[model samples]
Target chain A: MKVKKFLIGLADVFRFIKRFFKEVFYPPFEIKETLRQCFLLGNRSLFLILFTSFLAGIVFTKQSRPSLASFGAESWLPSLVSQAVVRSLGPLITGLICAGKLGSNIGAELASMQVSEQIDAMEVSGTRPYAYLVVSRVLATTLMLPLLVVFADIVALLGSYLMVNGINGTSFTLYFNEVSAVVTYLDIFSSLIKSAFFGFAIGIVGSYAGYHSEKGTTGVGKAANTAVVVSMIFIFVIDLASLQIINLFRVQ
Target chain B: MRTETDIIMPAPSQPRGNAVVEVRHVSKSFGDREVLVDFNLDLFERENLVILGKSGTGKSVAIKIMVGLLKPDSGTVNVLGYDVPTLSTKELNALRLQVGFSFQGSALYDSMTVRENLEFPLKRNLGIYNRSELDEKVMSALKDVGLESASNLSPAELSGGMKKRIGIARTLILNPKIMLYDEPTAGLDPVTSSEINELILSVRDKYNTSSIIITHDISCARETSDRIVGLFDGRNKVEGTFDELKKQNNEELKPFFNY
Candidate 1:
């Protein structure tokens, strides 16, 4: 039964993908409306992403200070911060940021639809509900998370850069050069790849939970909470697996 | 008691106009609880059939089954000649092209404006139309519901009655052959309820579309329904024209009549 249910879920994923392509590219692009959603999901999240990345960067720099000082390798701070910010922390942090915003929002929105029978209304209107709800969020997350992560990377690096400058004067040009030298295309690509998976997982899981919700108001709340928790856990798992794959190939 | 319209039998061999929906011996149960037991109904083209019953009597369940949102435990639901339970997803999509529904609470997308809500379906399903054509349809549907001025406003800004009207407008955008309404007049002021009833009747007349309405409002049911089917304990207890049901003062239907 468990295997059957798993296979059904896999099938549902493919079904959703098919609907997604149809709804997204078909002529009546809700481009203006979708852009509005993008702004809500991506642009509005900028400040929260910036604040969290700044604090995280500050803490990382402060903690790494004593360890690198012991080895007289404090100059490695720029490379270390840049690599961490760009590769792992940036995407993870940005995902978590969106998990709080987009995940919960999507859950609440869809849950309300389920609770109020709006989804059924869509189905009866000859409109595919999955195509409209799940696909829109998937596209939004796909486009938004990467953009948000880029913003986060810059904020985190700049935050860490400020911390390094406070401790010892390092020129921006020199610091950036060091960051570019240590971080390869592979590292950046791997991070981005993981973030996309994270985005997809977050959007789909959130939508699936909310769309299938049977409970009423309480159900909506529970769906929102569960979407974030489950997506966050999956994000970590995907992140680790991506890192492993990147490492495996790099070793060759 | 049933209405005069219910007494008029469906003409045999004659095309009942569009024959919008046909349900044959549909039975649905959730686990051991039989929500719908051997239910049968035929909705004619452009006819409004109100299903009246108390809560938990499977009125909503009946509509869900008809629309292919829920599969019947056994029996066939033939809408536009496509067997609902057996339809592939693509086929179901094609079948859905001819049906429309308005939920009890109007189920407007709260995040979107009335225009966006109306436009979402138009753009997705009828994507070939240019923006102007889409705009014309959206405006026309909103006008049909008397919500033309509220187009750009978000759903949150509309009154409950206006929301319901907007919901109807959204349903009309596709120009469906059949419309399913679940408690269209529930939870509204008496005046608003009457307005909705009038609007529903006017809509069917204008579009020549059949409707299956699940409702508890007796006045609304009597006013809007051509046929009234009474459901109790997942079974169709009594069905007749509104005048006929109203005339039968049987003990079994006494309580429903009092309301």
Candidate 2:
């Protein structure tokens, strides 16, 4: 039963992605509404993303201090923190946070619309709901996540600098030079690519869950909850796959 | 015990002007539960047809088929002379411009205000862009539904009747030729339902649009339906003008007249 449900879910996700692609590039693009969704989903998530990434960097530095110090490599803390924040931790944590916020939000919103016949109303009115609802959201998340990750990496690195300063009285300028020296453009690019994929996962999963919601209001709630859980799982899957691709590039 | 299959076929399509919506021999089933079977309807130009059925009797399914929202298992649903299920996505979308549907839930967008909801179809479907014309149209539609004052409110802020009015107003914004209303009075109080019925009549008269209102709200049918068709056991059963049908002596049809 579980395997059957999983296969069905996988197929549904593929179909949703297919539909998004088909309708996304069509004309009469609902540009204004898409911008509104981008503002709502992306800009609205800034505070939560900021708070999570800040805490993540502080915790990472605090946890790693003793081990690195035991190895007598304490001064390397700034570079190490920057590498972790930019390459993985910042984006991963940001993705997970957005999966919770935007996933539940988009899922609940669309699921409620499904229950209320707003979707059908759109369909029969000759306004393509898929183009307006799914494409705009997926595009917003795909474009915005990388931007959010960039913002998060900056905030997290700042938190990491504060942690380093608290531990060994390291000056802000000195910390910055260390981080800049170690963190290459490759690290920045890979983080940006990975976060974009994470955003795609969040948008697609949330939309699929909500769009296919059944059993009315209870189903809407379930769809929202499932969207968060499933989106988080997809984030991890994407992280692993992208890391492998990055590894292939490194090996070459 | 008598199903349409055993004895009745859909009543012979009486001559009505230029059949704009036709559902012929259409049957639909979900799993083993058949919702519609051999259902037939001919909605003529500028006619108000009410389809009456108890809950789960496929009145909703019948309309869904008419609007191309659902495909029948077998048989054809043609709207405005175009076959519904056979139309390509692009073609179906184009066809949708002439057909307006009001959901039983009054499915207003929760994120948009009343004015925005009304403007959605106008902007997209009708391709109307002149700001003054758009404003004038929106106001007229809202005023027609007695909701001109509530134009700025979110759908969540509106009462049940108000939401239904907003739904009808939004449908009107496109100036569609055919309106498919699914249980327009399903969840309202008696007074509100009556008001909705009156609004349906007014909309029909004002717009001269063909309509199929699916409801068990007998009073609504009596008030607005130019012709009332009963759907029973997954097929079209009996149809007549409301008063003529009410005067029928059939024992099995007795339950429907209790209203």
B14-122 per-residue lDDT for model 1 (tens digits): 2456566777777888878889988888887767888988888899989888778898988888898888899887788787878888888888877679998998787
Q: Write the per-residue lDDT of candidate 2 for residues A142-239, one digit (tens) a residue.
A: 88899999999999988888888887899999999999999988788998999999999899889988898995789899999999999999999999
Native contacts retained per candidate? 0.88, 0.93
Task: Report iRMS values in order.
Answer: 1.4, 0.9
Task: Give the range where candidate 2 chain B is weakest over 10 consecutive residues by summed lDDT.
Answer: B2-11
> For this target, which candidate reaches the highest DockQ against the unseen true structure?
2
lDDT of 2 at A124: 86
Question: lDDT per residue, candidate 2, B1-259, as tens digits?
Answer: 3332333122233467898988889999998999998889998987889998889999988988877888899998889879999999889988888888998888999888998898888888778878899899999999999988998999889999999999999988878899989999988997788778878878877898889999988777777788988898887889888778888985646887874
Evaluated on CA atoms against the true complex, candidate 2 attains a DockQ of 0.87
lDDT of 1 by residue, A192-214 (tens): 77888888888877887788776
Cα-based lDDT for every prediction:
0.82, 0.87
